[model samples]
Target: MSTDGASVHFSELVNRNRRTLARLEGSRSLLLRRRDGEDLVLTTASRAEQDRTVVSAATRMLLAMARREPGSMELLLDLLPDAFPWVRFLPETDLHAFAVELVDTMRAADSVGNNASVAQLLVEWQHTAEVHSDPELLAALTTDHGEDYGPVPDPREVA
Candidate 1:
C-alpha cells in the first residue's frame, strides 16, 4: 500500500480499522469514492480545529436565521449571549464578522420585494465566500460591508 497527496491507499484504512481506529484520538476515517477508484483516508485536526469547525457551522446557521427572520438580527444581537452560547467561544473577529454579516443581510433585504429570496442569496454568497476566504482573516471585502453606523464603546464598558 502507498499514499500520495491528500489521500491514502485503501489498505491503510483497513489496517487502521483492524486496529480499531478511533476519531476520538484526533483522527477521522473517511471513505472516498470516486469514478476511478475508492480510497480511505485518515483525517486529523487539533481540538482547536474541531472547536473552530463547530463554532463556524453554528455561526453560519445563526447568520442564516438572522437574515431569514425579519428583525431577528437585532433580536439575536440583543440576546446573543443568552440565545446562542456558542458565540461566546468565537474569536473577537469572528464575532465582529457575524454582526457585520447579519447587518448586511438585513440591508440586502430592504430593496427586494421578496426579502426571503434576498436573504437566501446573501446566505449563498456567504457560503461561497467562506470557501475562498483565508481562515485567519476575519473580515475581507468578500461581500458587501453593509453600512456604517459610526463608532461606539463596547456595550459592557458603557456606563
Candidate 2:
C-alpha cells in the first residue's frame, strides 16, 4: 500500500530469513540481508553473532557508526593490528571478524571524546582478545604481565 508500509514489510521479511541463515562463517550481525532483491527476515538479535566472545555495547555503537558513515570505519581499522594483541588467542579463522568489530568499537568510543571510557574499553578488549586468541597469553599471565612479543612466524608456519 504505502511506501512506509512496504518498507516495514520488507524489513520484517529480511529479519525472518536472516534468522534461518547459518551466519555463513558462523558470524552474524543484526544487519538485514536481501535474497532475490527483497527483505527476508526480522531481526532477533541486537548484535552480530560471534564466536569466542560477546559483542559489547561499545562494539555495537561502533558498528552503528560504521553503518551511518562508512568512512568512520577507517578510524577504527587504524588501531587494530596492535591494539588487540590478544587476537593471538582467537582461532585464526575468526580473527578477521573479531578485528573488524574490535576496531569499530574503538572508533565509536573515540568519537565522543570520552578518553577515559574509550581507554578502559580498549584495555578490556585487548585483555579479552589476548586471552582468547594468543596461545602465548598464558605465558604472559604467568610471566607477570610482561609483553615482550618476539616476531611473527613465516606464513608457512601458520598452517
Candidate 3:
C-alpha cells in the first residue's frame, strides 16, 4: 500500500479502537510507540473526573501554601468568599481545617455527580454561620471533628 493509504488505515484503526474501549470500559487509552523502545499511554477523563482531580489538586496546593506562608491562609479566606460562601465567616485560624472539610465535601458531591452541590453546601454553611452567633457552635459545625476532636481522658480534665 502507498504511504498515504497506510496512514489513513492506521488513523481509522486508532479511532475505532478508542470508541470500542470507551464503550466497554467507560474510558479510552491510546498507546504511542517510540523509537527508543518506550511506549506512552494516554487516557481520557470524563468531565466529572476532570473536575474532581482539579479540585483535589487545588485544595492540596492551597493547604500547602497556607502552611508555608501564614499570611496566605488569610489571603485564601479573603479570596474564597466570592466563590465559596462559607469561607467568609470561617476564622482565619480555622482555614486549614475548613479547607480540609471543603475538599471532602467536594469529593462527596463529585461522587454523587452533582457539580452544583458544592455551591449549595457553601451557601448552607454561610447561613448557618450567620444564624449561630456562638463561636463554639460554628467551630463544631466547620471543624473536622464536629463538636469534639476526640474524647478527653477523664484524667486529662482540669479541676
C-alpha RMSD by candidate, in order: 17.2, 16.0, 16.0
Query: Where in model 1 is the C-alpha error above 4 Å?
Result: 1-46, 81-98, 101-159
lDDT of 3 by residue, 25-96 (tens): 443444544455555444456744775688667655655665677687567566666776655555655555
Alpha-carbon local distance difference test for all models: 0.54, 0.51, 0.57
Over 1-159, each residue of candidate 1 has an lDDT whose tens digit, in order, gives 232333434554456754434432434434433445755445455644674566556555666777787787667666755744555655556655666665565454443423474457546645544544455453454465787788987999987
CA-RMSD of model 2: 16.0
Candidate 3 collision pairs: none
Top candidate when judged by lDDT against the true structure: 3
Evaluate model 3: give its lDDT: 0.57
Model 2 per-residue lDDT tens digits across residues 39-151: 44332244323221243455556567656676665554545556655555556554556556555555655556344555675567666666665557656655755565789
Q: Could you estimate the TM-score for every candidate?
A: 0.25, 0.27, 0.34
Give the lDDT of residue 141 in candidate 3.
Answer: 69
**Which has the greatest TM-score?**
3
Q: In candidate 2, which residue ranges exceed 4 Å CA deviation? A: 1-84, 133-159
